[model samples]
Target: MTISPDVAAVSTSRSQRARHYVMTRPTFFTVAYAINPWMDTTTPVDVERAVAQWETLRATYSTLGHTVDLVDPVPGLPDMVYAANAGLIINGTAIVARFKHAERDGESVAYATWMDRRGHAPVSTFHVNEGQGDLLVVGSMILAGTGFRTDPRAHAEVAALTGMPVISLELVDPRFYHLDTALAVLDDTTIAYYPPAFTDRARAQLQQLFPDAIEVSSTDAYVLGLNAVSDGKHVVHPAQATGFAEQLYHAGFHPIGVDLSELLKGGGSVKCCTLEVFS
Candidate 1:
């Protein structure tokens, strides 16, 4: 059937207005001075460096117009990133996550409280899986990675919990650990990833998801914190992401690099240390 002029224009506008909604942890929201794994057991210079890094990241994000909400770091949980993992923002409300590590199990309560105070509540929760960090949101499907931090059960758990299809891949390197660690969905049309992080099948699926994804290298990927919030054409990589910075610049992303020297000692990089909630 042919459409009227007004109806056609309205339909096109609605289609173009569609945008991806993401939940990111404001780097400043957490008690990183006491919780970042980089401190290990804690030291003089370590604490000082962590504080500076956190402050700078907080200011950077604030300047970008994102609202930052500070949350009390779950005492004794070193993986505060897990707290951000607790809620998966979909539609609008937060979807609480079932963290694999016991160290972060308490976030369910902490985040639930945070959401409650903000006049939001979690609609559902996973007893066996984490957030979309391991689960990449490409189009309508969720590509989740299994092994290492993410258990095999996490795959079925997340898929069943969220009512979304899950494609799971084995971890290529224990070091890279999380899916976001070695890969990033730069845009619906592009993904920034390194080969070492993907399997043959995973790579193929990624290609199918976004054919225009520009391939980056592990060297730069590691430094840039590949998973540190891609897309939006604005990348917040670590100061060390030299090669990736150039790539981001070429791709039209304003790459803002923050110092992360202390984080390296904890076996985590920029992405691991911080949670980014979208505005």
Candidate 2:
């Protein structure tokens, strides 16, 4: 029995796509050069120092032999969430997000420009919803956090855009600003998150998705800088969370913690410094 040419080609394409794990890594990270986000601390001096960390982080990734792309900025808006805002690498194209926050409204220009200049074609743009803040791209499904930076309508839009079901996680607490802040997908069957941080239902949903989630303490969460890396498996949190560090070790990730007192003062953790561009 001979398979059709289209069937063989499609089978190989599916295999190749599955092997490509979509994760964002920052090469260019700036700490709001246009704003005083340091919160009166002299540690970083200015946003330049924070951006310097990106340079260092890139060098580290280079050692690991992972080729990363650092995206340029959209002019005017200072606190544009490069990691949290726009451009999700779902299937093969970058689906630009419609951010919920007005301050970050114009943030897409820079992303669009980068995609254009680099020949990174975006599949499409959404005028209906917000950006990556609402998304949590796991093994297969896309989990979306509603009532925060992402909208309910946007959730439906992402589902149609990515051709993957977008699961909704309501933002019960404003403090856990993004979906990632409260939870993370460590692997297809494992997770790393604090219990109290997630709602009863959200926690239940996480448990359903990843049953072997490594529960983290509130204190551990703060110290580990759990809010940074988009991919939980490849995390770079603060070194302070000893317990979480051990948990990460068992999970098979080499943790890189930084002196984040300066970065934390402005309410950003490890994930903020890195904005991932998926190919």
Candidate 3:
């Protein structure tokens, strides 16, 4: 595949931009119920370790010259720690998530309250949408995932709200329920993804859109390595995803590994716990 000049420039220069992020402390993190394949209710959780790991992720963001904001954790909402599902904040508008499952439905209100208090114009949608979990911003387009968590109808809502062209991608694997789980946006033009997780049409779309994108191995994809947060230059991903880390380095981007294994039991990692707030 011929790499575009813009993508080549991004690889060569490795330019970075400061980001504003919202993170929730894993104060109530645990696997009490099974919502995804990574969650096993029978497996015991280490709450203390989860909190420590979350703190480290937060500190890492601060160390990277990015601003970090915190939202108070709700007691019964264990999955609230995955703050990225709360809402999609972009272009000065916050489209709060309406979760598909009842288990996480309450999170929408909590996140909306936080966004409202912070002066972000919070908009509510009747359709089911898991915020950044299913919607990822890539340059001027929004890549939306469906067939698992978020509803296809929400794709139109996102386009209407943000005024950005949305490309709908169908997720076939149960494990990679969210778009973030199977794909990571490395920068405005670059992406890293696992092809098997998507439908044939979605895979074709990705290949057409990002010809120079990195195709990660299943080994790294299972570890939620594609659930990474990138700041144009630096990619923050799971420590267990060693192969993905090496790929990022070879692609001319710096990859920082962070251990969020404790939270991984709940089926989330770096990007899952972190939500980028575009003001």
Best by TM-score: 3
TM-score of 3: 0.96
Which residues of candidate 1, in runs, are more than 4 Å off? 1-45, 81-83, 123-127, 160-163, 273-279
Compare candidates 2 and 3 on TM-score and give the better one. Answer: 3
Per-residue CA lDDT of model 2 for 31-62, tens digit only, reads 44322223333434345555555455555545
| 10 residues in a row with least lDDT, candidate 2 | 14-23
RMSD of 1: 8.0
TM-score of each: 0.75, 0.75, 0.96
| lDDT winner | 3
Model 3 Cα lDDT, one tens digit per residue, 1-279? 465676567577988899999999989888989989999999999999999999999999999999999999999999999999998999987999999889998898899999999999799777899999999999889999998999999999999999999999999999999999999999899999999999999999999999999999999998999999999999999999999998888787888999999999999999999999875
- Give all candidates' CA lDDT scores: 0.58, 0.56, 0.93
Kindly provide the TM-score of model 1 when superposed on the true structure, using C-alpha atoms. 0.75
Specify the poorest-scoring 10-residue window by lDDT in model 3: 1-10
Off by over 4 Å in 3: 1-12
Using lDDT as the measure, what is the rank order of every candidate, best first?
A: 3, 1, 2
Model 3 RMSD vs true structure? 3.4
Total clashing pairs for each candidate: 7, 8, 0
Alpha-carbon shift of residue 96 in model 2 (angstroms)? 1.1
Provide the global lDDT of candidate 2 against the true structure. Answer: 0.56
